[model samples]
Target chain A: MKLTRRKRNMALITMTPLVDVMMILLVFFMVTSTYLDLDMMPMVQSESEGVAAPADPAPTLLIRITASGEARLRGQPLTAQSLASALASQPRARVLILPSGGANVQALVSAIETATKAGAENLRVVRLEAAE
Target chain B: MKLKRRTQPPPQETIVSLIDVIFFLLVFFMLVGRMDATAPFEVSPPVSAAGESLPKGGTTIAVAENGALALDGEAIERPALLAHIADLLSKKPGLFVRINAHGEARLTNLLPLVTALERAGVGDVVLVITPNPA
Candidate 1:
């Protein structure tokens, strides 16, 4: 009975092995995971009727936003009010907003608001398509 | 009476089993973690109704979120971007421009630069995207 008690007390409960295994597994996952930095933007399909129309002769104003949140109109710096006034002077025809690859959504929205306030009849947001 | 203590052998715990588990997990993650390298550039280019994939190795332009312009990772000032393209055009005719924009980048930052590119005679501009890994 004393030997049995001694044997029971001697049972090992080591944790080093378990810890080693876990560490290796963690490192493995960290290296193997794909690191994608870009997020997908929401896209809306243009209506068929809109697509059928021929290109209008009226000058199309282009608005671009950069990743750092700077906004430019035709390579010129213009405030919201100035942009609005510029759009208002146009024929109220077509306004194209072409944002950079990582442009902010808020900037785009603000630009759209300015264009609409300037009485732009047709406003289209255009993105560059990746060539296959 | 004095008692004599008997020496016992150390507990037998092998690290082989633990190492095996670790190796298995390592291999599993290596296989599962394949991700697209180009997805982080965040430029969602406009897709045309008749859009087709072009071959790689085109001239690349990086439009950072801050509206900074980089041609093949080399930063260029906004005023100089057009001139740089024109110079490149003389050296390598028909060079396509690939725009890799960030998602948080504002559209206001891209429009004028693109217009400038067009004016500078960059006829072919391509956007880069990573296909969804299902």
Candidate 2:
């Protein structure tokens, strides 16, 4: 006499737990993420392609930013039109932005914006070191 | 004659489509979002028109309006922060350092910190700025 054994059915895998985990992660990322449009300005670049010097000593234009965030050119307040016209006359002039230590970052950025808009190609921010 | 009423079986609700949708959403959030450690204090970066696009991967140092300092979302003192940065620089000489300073922060607080970082042998340093101010 020959004896035959019965086959056992396989267990079913549930996908509910996986779906729950994915949903949790989605919500967590959505809540914690901030959508800010950010940009960068290089503070220190080791390998700078130094700009070549002009044939003659380049004339420099000094723009002073006061503690109140006012930008002055030649002791006059900065105006976009006046600055553009002045730059148009001497296009090769290097612009030096001398900001007071008390001034905010916005003030420095605003002054740089004005200078760039006025077609100043060679621009530099002059940092002040406190005398010890 | 008596007519018997016949009932049809209910349609099956397939969860495959639900899983597919959730998977896509999960991948979307993971790919698009930058998982950066936020600063403990509020920092509104200065607005700039000429700033270039920032690349991923770096250590972030936050500067508050009152000259407070934070590194990677934890508030830290200047000396400790510099010492920590020095240690990182020794391990990885080319570590990119990002300074996320508040818009109203004085340059006195910002410039000196940058000078110290440079003195600590930081090869590349970038300032974080916002293209659009809200």
lDDT of 1 by residue, B1-134 (tens): 99999999999988768767777777777665543334333445332222234444656667766667676656777767677889998897776676666545655565556556665666666444433333
- What TM-score would you report for chain A in candidate 2? 0.84
lDDT of 2 by residue, B35-122 (tens): 8888899999999887789999989999999999999999999899999999998889899999999999998888778777877888
Which regions of candidate 2 are displaced past 4 Å? A1-5, A49-55, A130-132, B1-5
Every candidate's DockQ is: 0.10, 0.72
Task: Write down the TM-score for model 1.
Answer: 0.38
TM-scores vs. true structure, each candidate? 0.38, 0.89
i-RMS for every candidate (Å) is: 10.4, 1.5
Give the per-residue Cα lDDT of candidate 1 at A107. 54
Measured as a fraction from 0 to 1, the native contacts recovered by model 1 come to 0.17
* Superposition-based RMSD of candidate 2 using all C-alpha atoms, in angstroms: 2.5
Top lDDT: which candidate number?
2
User: Candidate 2 has what TM-score?
Assistant: 0.89
